[model samples]
Target: MATFSTRYSRLRDNVEEEPNSSAFDEIIMKQEQIIRDQDEDLELVGRSVNTLKHMSTKIGDELNEQAVMLDDLGNEMDTVDSKLNNVMKKIAKLTHMDDGKCTCSQT
Candidate 1:
C-alpha cells in the first residue's frame, strides 16, 4: 500500500510540472512571433524610404532641367533687348535733322 501511495504522489508532481513547462513554451512562441512581426515592419519601412529617395532624386533632376531652360530663356531675352535698342537708335537718327531741328518745318 505504501508503494502505491509513492507512485501516486510522483504522478501528481509530474502532472503539475507539465503545465509549467507548457506555459514556458507558450511564452517563447509568442516572443518569436513578436520578433518576426517587427522584422517584417522594418523591411516595409526600408522599402518606403527607398521609394521616397527615388522620387526626390527625380524631382531634383526636373528642377535642374528647369533651371537650365530658364538660363537659356534669359540669354535669348538679352539678345532681343540688344536688337530692340539698335532699332530705336536707327529711328532716332532718321527723325533728327543735321541741325538738331524737326524735319517737318512750320509754314
Candidate 2:
C-alpha cells in the first residue's frame, strides 16, 4: 500500500541499517517479558478460583449439616406436642367427672 511519493522520503534514505537489528531485538525482548508477566497473572487467577471453590464446598457441607440438625429438632418438637395433647385430654376427662368425686363402692 505504499504510494510512490510516501515510500522514498529523505529521512528514510538518511537512516542507517545497523541500528534496525538492535532495535528489533529490544522489541522482541519486551514482548517476551510481557508474555511472562501475563502467564504469572493467569496462574494467580487460577489459584484464586481454586480457593473460592474450596470455600464454597465447605460452606455447602456446613449448611447440609445444619439442615439435618434442624430437621431433627422439628421432629422432637412434634413428639413433645403430641404428648402435651394427650395430657390435656386426660385432664379434661378428669375435670368432667362428678365434681372431682369417684364412683367407687365402699367394702
After aligning candidate 2 to the native by TM-score, how far in Å is the CA of 3 from where it should be? 20
lDDT tens per residue, model 1, 27-100: 99999999999999999999999999999999999999999999999999999999999999987887896888
After the best TM-score superposition of candidate 1, give how far the Cα of residue 25 lies from its true spot, in angstroms: 1.8
- Model 2 segments beyond 4 Å from truth? 1-19, 98-107
Judged by whole-model lDDT over C-alpha atoms, candidate 1 comes out at 0.89
Q: lDDT per residue, candidate 2, 1-107, as tens digits? A: 87665555465554655568778999999999999999999999999999999999999999999999999999999999999999999877766686877554459
Clashes by residue pair, model 1:
none
The C-alpha RMSD of each candidate to the native structure, in angstroms, is 11.9, 6.2
Task: Give per-candidate clash totals.
Answer: 0, 0
- Listed in order, each prediction's TM-score against the native is 0.67, 0.68
